[model samples]
Target: MNETENDYHGYTPMDYDEDSAADEAYQTCVSYIVEHAPIERDDTVVDVGTGTGIVALELASKCDRVLGRDIDDEWLRYAREKAAERGVENVSFDHGSFREPNVEEAVDVVVASYALYMAYDEGGEGTLRAAIEGISSLNPRHLVVADKMFFGPPEPRGGYETLPRMGTVANLLADTGFTLTDVEIVSGSAGVLVASRTSG
Candidate 1:
């Protein structure tokens, strides 16, 4: 393998199963997008924090094209291979950070899955601000964020007290000029928050 391929993030595409149960998580997220988005067949969608191209591949079928962006080159390679395996010609991957996406092309819809949370620390105040700005810079017609809020008792991985409440993020979105359009909680373990760009 080339050094570039090996030096990328630790993610190995082959390590992720295309048919894993986690795929249900992806599918659930996609369903939320199709439901809340004013998606059009001609729209070009961007899947920020796209891991293994799951959301990007799903969007490819519903949009004119789909681009998956991630900072990990290994994950990008894996995403490309997955796209190739599925013969999804309209889906592509780029090695970049969604927090500071570097793409010239504007998209119609931007979807950020669980990947957004990793960009922040406890409380996620700064992280949410950066995330909103990053998504806004894309100038997409809509922004969809799929994340989970921990409201349970304390645990080793940090519990509710260690994380920002969903309402905190909702307020952060408002402060950053995003209007909440829909909210959904899945399996009592995750919450999906969808919002649209609005003037500050």
Candidate 2:
């Protein structure tokens, strides 16, 4: 398959029931965020590239409102339907990119699961900078990032490559004015990083 096809296939939603490993890792990441992040009642959150609303739905249960933004309209639609089916009224989904999110007001927390790394690899430093700038504009108190960690060179996958180490991610967050607070490595190679905005 070509690069485009590979990339598209990589992001194609999987059946959660069939993918036990992925599901477990996802749940672990969600639990880590809930325990470590500053997510609380009355807080508004934005889940960037929120595919199918897994993280968004989880946050909705804890926070007052959650907006799940993704570039895929199909995923956003599915997320909205899933929220409704689950009777989660505090969550909503929209079509947008993490580099240029569509949220208007300042949110209390921003969570990106396995999404920012794709942006970083696809667009390189420019996309990474854009993502940080966009998140900064929201003035969030906390940020949560979860992705696979590559100790060596990033290996090619379905459509993209793996991300750098947790240290690299921490430096990027620090460059964007966020202070690293916590990190958890799970499923062996996959990990989550939580950061808080530094006071000016």
Model 2, residue 35: distance off in Å is 3.0
Off by over 4 Å in 1: 1-11, 18-27, 34-36, 151-162, 187-189
RMSD of each: 4.6, 3.7
C-alpha RMSD of candidate 1: 4.6
Error of 2 at 38 (Å): 1.4
Top model by TM-score, which number? 2
Off by over 4 Å in 2: 1-23, 151-160
Q: How many backbone overlaps does candidate 2 show?
A: 1
Backbone clash total for model 1 is: 0
* Model 2 poorest ten-residue lDDT run: 1-10
Question: Per-residue lDDT for 127 in model 1?
Answer: 62
lDDT of 1 by residue, 19-124 (tens): 4336676567667766666668998888877767766787787889888888767678888998898899998788656557767786788888766665544325
